[model samples]
Target: MKEFDLIKQYFAQRGHVRKDVILGIGDDCAITKVPDNQHLAVTTDTLISGVHFLADAPARSVAYKAVAVNLSDLAACGAEPAWISLSLSLPSYDEAWIDEFVNGLYELTEYYSVQLIGGDTVTGPLALTITAQGFVPPDTELRRSNAKPGDWIYVTGNLGDAGAGLDILKGNIEASAEHRDYLINRHYYPTPRVLAGTSLRRTANTGIDVSDGLVADLSHILRASGCGATVHVDRLPVSSALFDTVGAQQAYRYALSAGDDYELVFTVNEEQRGNLETSLANANVKATCIGQVNGYTGQLDLRLYDAKYELDKDAGYEHQF
Candidate 1:
């Protein structure tokens, strides 16, 4: 099939979309209107075969992840996701593959009420690029530069499941049937903390998504805020399945360095603790206080049972150029 045919066959539907999207798919460029008094938030992410996911993995999952990771960034910025554009590159077209891939993409967009606006298709070693845009109230968007030294640090959802999931997929280790499926699903279908991020926007001092593990992502905030942190390893939230399957130490390693979890790590002031709790409650999400912001510069101090813990500074995934 030709490129335009592929797009029309699988992705041309746009009957229902947010009022902001004036023009979507099939146009030379999509048009959107930002709400008055709100700031436009945009984020983009690219997923490459092998590096980001297993080459033989399900196409639907890849599409879902491509949209999800970009939306995750919008969520981190405390924006309400509204639209997405996709650029998919493949070696060749397969009707069945395209169908499944589009289905996965629609599933997430439908859930979030996000519209697919415009994109391109090309022949290449498989890759998927997504650009998502949203709106956040002016002066209230979460950022990496606002954390204060006395603020309490918190993280939404458990950490390291996706990291463990990836290792299992790569066959480096074995897992029980139930645990394997759970972890694998966690890796493939990550839940972006959109609601939680929105809820925390007015209260959070600073925030970021855990795309590259806790330490690395949090470091972005620390560096931007010009502050340091003390993250308690003991406070790291790991699923019971992870503890039972991989034991504590390995779980700790993955929680600290394994990337792709997409959870939100944020800080709240001591006085705003009540407000933070109330916001998470309204969002029906759970968050754990993992540590505190400190005075040290660009430092990440890991604590284990009250003592300073150490790990590879190279922890977490950094795309090697």
Candidate 2:
């Protein structure tokens, strides 16, 4: 199929329809309205085959992950997702693959009530880029620079499961069938904490989504806020599947350094601690208090029951470029 034909058949007029989108697909530029008194939050992410996902991974999963990761960025800013534009590059046209990919993309956009705006399709290496836009109330957006000393650090949902799942897919680890399926699904379908992030706008002093490992993402908050943190290593949340398959030491290492979990890591000061619990409860999201911010700027201290704990290697994912 030709480029425009492919877009019309699989992408245009598909997915959730948002009223805020004045002009979506088939337009020179997407025209969207920002609600009065709200600010626009925009994020873009690119996923390349073999680099971001396994080259042989399902097209559906690749599409879903592309949308999820960008939405996770908006969630960290406490924005309500409203629209997305996709730029897809494929080595060649594959009808069945495109069908499944559109299904996956629409599945997530529908769940989040996001509309597809506009974008381009090009012939190139397999890669997908999504630019997601959302709305956030002015002065209420969560930011990494807002954290303060004495604030308690909290993370929503378990960590390390996705990393473990990647290892299993790579044949670097083994697990029982049931556990294997669970871990693999965790890797493919990471839940972006949209509801939890919105709830945190009023209570959280600062916030970030755990795209990188917990330690790596938290370091961003520390640096941005000009503060440090003391994380209780034992308090890091690990899924039963990961713990069972990888033992305590390996599980802890994954929790500390592995990426792609997409959970939210936020901070709440003592004054807002009670309200934090209530806010999260209202959203029906569970969060664990894993550490506290400190005065030492840009420092991350990992402690296991009051004893210093150290990782054997560098923590978190980093691109060589």
Q: Once superposed on the true structure, which residue ranges of model 2 sit more than 4 Å away at CA? A: 318-321
Report clashes for each candidate as comma-separated counts.
0, 0
Local accuracy of candidate 1 as per-residue lDDT tens digits, 162-269 = 988888988977899999999998999998899988998889998899998888899999999999999999999999878877999889988988888999999999
* TM-scores vs. true structure, each candidate: 0.97, 0.98
The digit string of per-residue lDDT tens for model 2 on 1-321 reads 488988887777567777888888986898889999999999999998888888888888988899999999999999988889999999999999999898888889999998989899999999989999998998989999999999999999999998989889989999999999999998888887889878998888898998889988999999999999999989999999999999988998999888999999999999999999998998899899999999999989999889999986675675311
Best by the TM-score measure: 2
Evaluate model 2: give its TM-score.
0.98
* Index of the highest-lDDT prediction: 2
Residue 285 deviation, candidate 2, in Å? Answer: 0.4
Per-residue lDDT for 104 in model 2? 86
* lDDT score of residue 169 within candidate 2: 93
- Please estimate how well model 2 matches the true structure, expressed as its whole-model Cα lDDT: 0.90
Model 1 compared with the native: what TM-score?
0.97
